[model samples]
Target: MRFRFVERNRGFFGRVAVAVAGAVKASVAAIGVLALSASPAAAGPTPDYGIDFAIIGDPGNRHVNFDEGRRFYPPYAHEGFTVGTVNYKYRMSRTEITVGQWLEFVNAYRPYYDGPTNAGQFTSDWIVYDNSLGRYRAISGSENFAANMGWRFAARFCNWLHNGKVMEQWAFENGAYDTSTFGRDDNGNYTDQPVRHADAKFWIPNLDEWIKAMHWDPNKNDGEGGYWRYPTSSDEAPISGPPGTGETNAGTWNFYDVGSYPHTTSPWGLLDGSGGRSEHLETLASSSGVRLTNGSDWGGLVSFDEIDRTASELPISSRSGLRLGSIVPSPPAFVALLVVGAVVAQARRR
Candidate 1:
């Protein structure tokens, strides 16, 4: 079920006379960024299941803290690691996967659920199975709350979306990712794949995608660009409070509904990137079991607003939510790039 990502090059540049191949590569890379920035991809229409996304552009952009000097509270060694460089364009969910959206997935996938028990499938506190209804439902007012179903279930959710929300066993197992690799090896090391297949339609955002969504601002540094210290496009930490009262929900005791702070957004327009629920990223913290998570939860400290901070969690840990990433629309990578060029031209003319 593994697929290779096909790299496509447009011959629009005709020919290059560079002596070094590396120079040609650099030149093409520059063109890609210029093309994408001049005409950034538009966020696709919301899907039938209702997950809206923010288009992240500016391919081949530089990473944050490239020299690795950035540090924050506690200053874990890995905290200094550089991130945010991504070479392709994709869309990231505007908010963490919400309870209502997960409910739709739960009802669609429940009839085919063959797991030993559904106990670990969701955060019992927010979503629950009703014996009378024979389907899962989000608790009373938690419909818009961020769902905390851990990493593996989140992967399954991606698989479901990749399969177009089909109500079949295979749809919940394979597509964007392979569930067969979900098991551990003889030496007790987890065998789950570290990333999604290249041809996937939708999957969990990797650490780079997550960081770029939360911090990278293309218009920064007088349009030359740079990353922000926080997801709110600001260097200062956000103020915490309930909906409409603060810039973020983190460092506060209560979990407000997703999008409670519509004005508080990442440079790319993603909401709740700093608080609400820590996001489950596909980047692995360790091969044994730990996976990487980004941002702070509703009860996180003020320092969690720092973009460099991250936490490690087991794949089965249900303490975090997730965000999905998808190629512009369908496959054939160059088509998406072409769309970017078309949009860019329109914007420039205006």
Candidate 2:
């Protein structure tokens, strides 16, 4: 099954933009400074059942490294559970992660940038929070809460949870700075532990996968006129009246938190997969040589449909976080023996 994302351009949403040229190119000098700490322990398996997703079915690239630079189409596009060079299986969970859970990772796995209150989150300087509004607004210089977090923090968290050790070591040596005296090392480095990259233990969900999970209109071909007003279930513009309400006439209206619908679920029961944050993805080329990154962040605004973009799309800010699903291996059952006449005699001897 697949999904289609729609957008209401009447709003003045200005997403973060990246220079396509700079984004596709590899910059080693900036990577070290750009890097941040990450650590994610195994949360265990998500118990996979052989249930096929039933929703819209339709169409939809990858590259890595800097030899010729990474590139991708429909950024953040990827294949899930490949079947002989094709992604035929669904690859995602249906949920928009909570701030509390992310806080745990920030506290235990990567706590270097934990700002003022020892919350162990990003620097508050990056964004602002309105308790009354219960939402995050862009700012800078480290702050706690989901809104202040940038694409960097989200990406770091994904790496840690997936391949804890490799991603963690890279960050500690690169982005992290010593903070606590009680947790110092011989070289003054905090003894931050590392996690591994064993499959997608916990990685960001792609935009398309997210769309499939959130409000996948089964009628894309069935000929229903719903969700045509906004992206998926998002009806109202922003700041005020929720998704099902009337549009606020774009610019005159203000932007609200991602997936404010509160009930935005795709055909597979996923939440805010497309709206909340810009989801990052790793793509590969048919040549088996390069990998590229496509993202949902787009400086904050993005849509599942190519025709939904409000402004020019960029590659930067594509970094986002992810949730996980599980599949467990079942044990075989043994058959019982009918009758054993000799068993009784052996018991009497004991």
Candidate 3:
């Protein structure tokens, strides 16, 4: 009987030990799952060339009333008196295309354009070649400055971005442009009026779209929705200077870095819309087939104070820059949570 009791006790202790070990393993697995679920998933790697965009939502079914004559101090008639409306919502780049981003495009498409030799000339005359660095660099002080390119070049840049940078499929195909939609001469000049595709992934913003994004105020006039006189989210003009300087001047060359003036953002929080580089608009002027440019540049006379619009008859020599616009998808809140849950489950399994 004593031997039998000892064996039974040993068997019971062995079973208890096994149960405890199994419980500990299950607890560890549960803790890992809880940790992953409680925390957000790690963000994906940043793109080599990424443009941060601001999502502009529709403002209670309202339209912008744009009239340069009434809004401007001297009653300028360049943009003309017009009422604008945007039916759908879109996203606009927070800042003009930066030198770094443009450089990536030039390096990717240099072989197709004119090989690596002429890559320096692809950006602008301002970009200088550095012998020591063995690469083209924007002027030392203008690293984050907006790129100065023509309308056609800007369009091609959009196409390059759409074609995934490595492939030259969309805009200029087989060492030539898709002439059925884009009109190009043998000399590589855009001969006809450029028309954007209906379902283009990325393109320049049209006049109405650009104006609305710049000035539309959804919660103005007791929430009835209205437009600001200027793009600075205020009736008064924007004061420009280098980033972090709080000085105001009508003609100060205050071309601050992108999104430097958070207070002077548009109604939808788009930065540098009023002061920086004059952005190219896809809209063509009525009389001339040339495209139009909006906003004020660094060097201009009260251009920052007004909704300035300049028609680009000569796009080649123009100091115009580009701000890309796109239609991006926004996932629902619950869907985002589910995505996180799935990621956590996968991590726990691993």
At residue 98, give the lDDT of candidate 1. Answer: 85
| Better lDDT candidate (2, 3) | 3
For residues 88-113, what per-residue lDDT tens digits would candidate 1 score against the true structure?
Answer: 78888899888888878777767766
lDDT of 3 by residue, 67-166 (tens): 4325422355445445446666667888888777777666555545653453332676346556797666666666677776767667777666555564
Estimated TM-score for each candidate: 0.78, 0.39, 0.68
Per lDDT, what order, best first? 1, 3, 2
Candidate 1, lDDT over the whole model: 0.75
True-structure lDDT of candidate 2:
0.32
* lDDT of the candidates, in the order given: 0.75, 0.32, 0.60
lDDT tens digits by residue: candidate 2, 1-350: 12222442323221101221222232322332222111122223333322222222222211111221112222432433221111223345443334544544444443344444322134222333446644443333212212323333444555444443353445433222111212335664323222113334444333333333333343543653222223334433223233566222122233343344545444444444444433333322222212222223313434332112211211123233434322221122110111122332333343
**Model 1: per-residue Cα lDDT at residue 30:** 60
Error of 2 at 327 (Å): 6.3
Model 2 TM-score on a 0 to 1 scale: 0.39
